[model samples]
Target: MAGLYTDQLKLGLDDVGWVFAIEQSGSIVGALLGFWLTPRVSWRPLIVGAAFLAAVANAFTANVDGFAALAALRFASGLGMMVATLVSACLLARSPNPDRAFGAGLTLNCLLNAVFVWLMAKLLAESGYAAAILSAAGLFGLILVLGLALSGDLRGDFEAPPATPESGAVRLAAARTGLAGLVLFGLAINMIWVFLERVGLSNGLQAGDLGNAFALGLLAGTAGSAIPFVVGDSGNRARMIAITTAGLVAGIALAWWATDYWTFVAAVAILASVWNMGLAYYMAMTAENDPTGRYTRAIYIAVVAAQAAGPAIAASLLEFSHIGTVFAISPLPAIFALLLVAAVAGAPRVEGSSLAR
Candidate 1:
């Protein structure tokens, strides 16, 4: 939402980058808190409290007067949302089909984002920025209510495994590889994503056209997330990751070569879809590696940190080089990360496959 209204927020590119960095920094902190609390605290109250905190933080954004205030509010919102997400991930990791569970979560997220993006665009056209922000706040408030209504037995389903040094070492090593891959994958996606609007405008696409394309891209992402949900982990995940990485590179190439609106739309759609698909696979892989939710929290932190770094690094590169150079450099990390995960995946499974208990 903030990305769509830079003019109204009176923010420069540097300010925008700082805001994102600050927000993600808060998530990293929240992930750390989740890491500590996941085993010690009950999941039900934690998720509900996190959602309420996020809702209150975002609701307060309506009164923000300057970049400082806006950044602070966003930081609070990120912290709350990350904690809620981490608790949810812990529960999903315990499900019968972790891949399908994660995919379904991603699908719902993408669908809601697509709908909200379209609604926000329309709302911004007819109303003030406060109304758009408050609408988001209202949605978070609804999530809080939903969280409250979940069964108390949900927390009982997760029991932290007693740690032994030999098993812990193996699990940590595998989880480390998955975390590395997810960091690079997230970074590569966001580097191009942050500048997509500029790319479209340079190619003669109008603002409205860009908005429509982004919403459509998110909808396409919903479909991509559904792939794992429907298929239910039937194939080799390493091969799927390889295919998705290639698709990410192809999406970036398409964007670089696009000269027309339809081409740009296609590029964005492919990128968004591929990103979500890759994320579901990555999340499932990490969850399988570390069922305790310790490294899972670490994975969340690394991913958010990469997301914060991607655009800042790209912006820095743009000062000295072309956007094409940034594009060329983006996928290299993903390719390296893929190799790391594949190498670890080829090893014997220490834990059972299918995330079955």
Candidate 2:
């Protein structure tokens, strides 16, 4: 949408929201679809296809002259990327260990996106939006080749666990219990994510400096997650989650209030590390209870839906709040999520679950 905003396409309000929806439609749809399936039905091919198509579609955007054409391309891009995301999620679920699975996934995603963004910035600097798109096309083409080689119709290795169909009453009760807490968690996390970059810019940080903040934060978080993978059991996962959420609350507040680069970076790193650790722990919990594969898919649906909606929900709150106020407000949701982690801990674990499964 930003690209279209600066292009001959001359996009406006729709571009900001609707166009984004269109462009990421594939990821949105594919993730939901992926959650509905089991490990044996891996969506890798769909994801692979999506990546290749996204590049092709992006490359062709240069030829588009008006809003309508741009919209079409954006919609196509959405379709492609969503499939890729869905594939990734399916893979995540199939991991024998959720925390380890998530740690690896986070690392891979961060590294790839970091490289991709660096290339994009370089391309944009040298040749503008069109060149950036072309550069992405080349990257996507490379992804397609690798995907084709490693995943020749072998994407569906995971299988859904058997369903012991519960009554509607039992299921609705479960959902009612979970809905509020999940929304709160999403809002809290996204609030931190969306505004962190802006905070850096507001503090007189140079262009692209925020990337370093994310890199450091994620690395710290990964290191923390590694500790649990080496020693902890599911019994103490809730405490870890609570501690991490508290850290996120404190980190966000400090980042909003702090002035120096060291202070801000320190806050960012703490926020990144603990928040991701919380996520890994929480995801592990979800996987534990999802032995039938059906429940696991549903959990993924909640997570993916949250991922799609969190930023928009956070942005809406920013309309009436100052930066400090907004940053402070996010803790409410983090607190709520911490409570959920505690409550969900009381739920039973289903055996033989995979993060990618």
Candidate 3:
């Protein structure tokens, strides 16, 4: 919803780079902060606070009459969004059932995107951005109440017995793999959101058209998030990374190289699908290595860092070349990194390792 109405979010970001940086900066910062915050603070405050802040801060985005105000609001909102997501993911990680755990994550990413985008579009349609943000604020208030009231058993005290490895080396290896996998997954998302959006908009595409592209990509992402569940243990996650990276890169290439609108949209769809696949695999890798979600924060750190750096890198590329050229360098390098990091994945468990919260 907020995404569909780019025109409504008034900012003096004439340079596409400025807008991309503002948009991604919030997510990156939020992720970085949230990843670390949730492990210590109770999830309740983090969730509710983030939701309220996001609603209030985003509303401010509509009313920011100057660049500095807009930037401040965005940074605050980004922190809120990341904290909320971190709390949600932490909750999901703690779920007793594996299927439900992954399902929770899937639902968060998909359902929220669907509901909020629709609500935002509708609210913006009738009342404008301010009204739309106000609606979001109301929902956040409700969540705050519910979370405050009902978090009786949200935290899992002691984790399940650790998975003891035959060798300490095995534990060390798994930790390295999980970190590497996370970095790759983060990079893939960076390429699409930061670079792709800028490309579509400044390169003669309409707002509705870009919204549609994003919508389709998100839809594909939802579908692609199930690889780990299906592939199971002993699955070649490394190969999956390679395949997904290649596909995402191809999609980006299509988006950049294609002159026609539909052609570009098709490319975006491929990216949407492949990126989701990568995320699922990465999450699975993380869980396999750190079922407790303790190391999840560190994973979050890497994820945030990659997301932040990827966009800036892409934007810098655009400065020297065309928007297309910026997107040209993505996902593949990240994928190669995954191979180097998580290559020897199909191994046994380890103690104090998976960072099981």
All candidates: TM-score:
0.87, 0.74, 0.76
- Per-residue C-alpha lDDT of model 1 across residues 199-281, encoded as one tens digit per residue: 77887788998877776666766777888788767767777788889989999998887777778878888898788777778
Answer with 1 or 3, whichever has the higher TM-score: 1
Over 4 Å off in model 2, which ranges?
Answer: 1-14, 24-26, 36-44, 126-129, 149-183, 197-235, 298-300, 307-325, 346-357
How many angstroms is residue 158 displaced in model 1 relative to the true structure, after the best TM-score fit? 5.5
lDDT of 3 by residue, 1-357 (tens): 334234554433463346456756788778777766665677777788888888787666666555566667766777777777667666655544333355446645676667777787788889877777666666666666766764755542425354555443455456456667667666755755656666676668887778776776676556555554455333455666677767776777777765557876787667766665665555555554554465655656677777777766766776778755555556566667665544454444444444211
Residue pairs clashing in model 3 are 1-117, 289-354, 290-354, 292-356, 292-357
lDDT of 1: 0.78
lDDT of 2 by residue, 222-283 (tens): 55555445534453666766677777777887777755666767877777666556555655
Best by TM-score: 1
How accurate locally is residue 314 in candidate 2, as Cα lDDT from 0 to 100? 68
List candidate 3 segments past 4 Å from native.
1-10, 14-29, 59-70, 95-100, 153-169, 197-211, 226-239, 316-328, 346-357
Per-residue lDDT, model 1, residue 120, is 77
Provide the clashing-pair count of each candidate structure. 0, 24, 5
Selected candidate, larger lDDT, 1 vs 3: 1
For candidate 3, give the lDDT of residue 261: 70
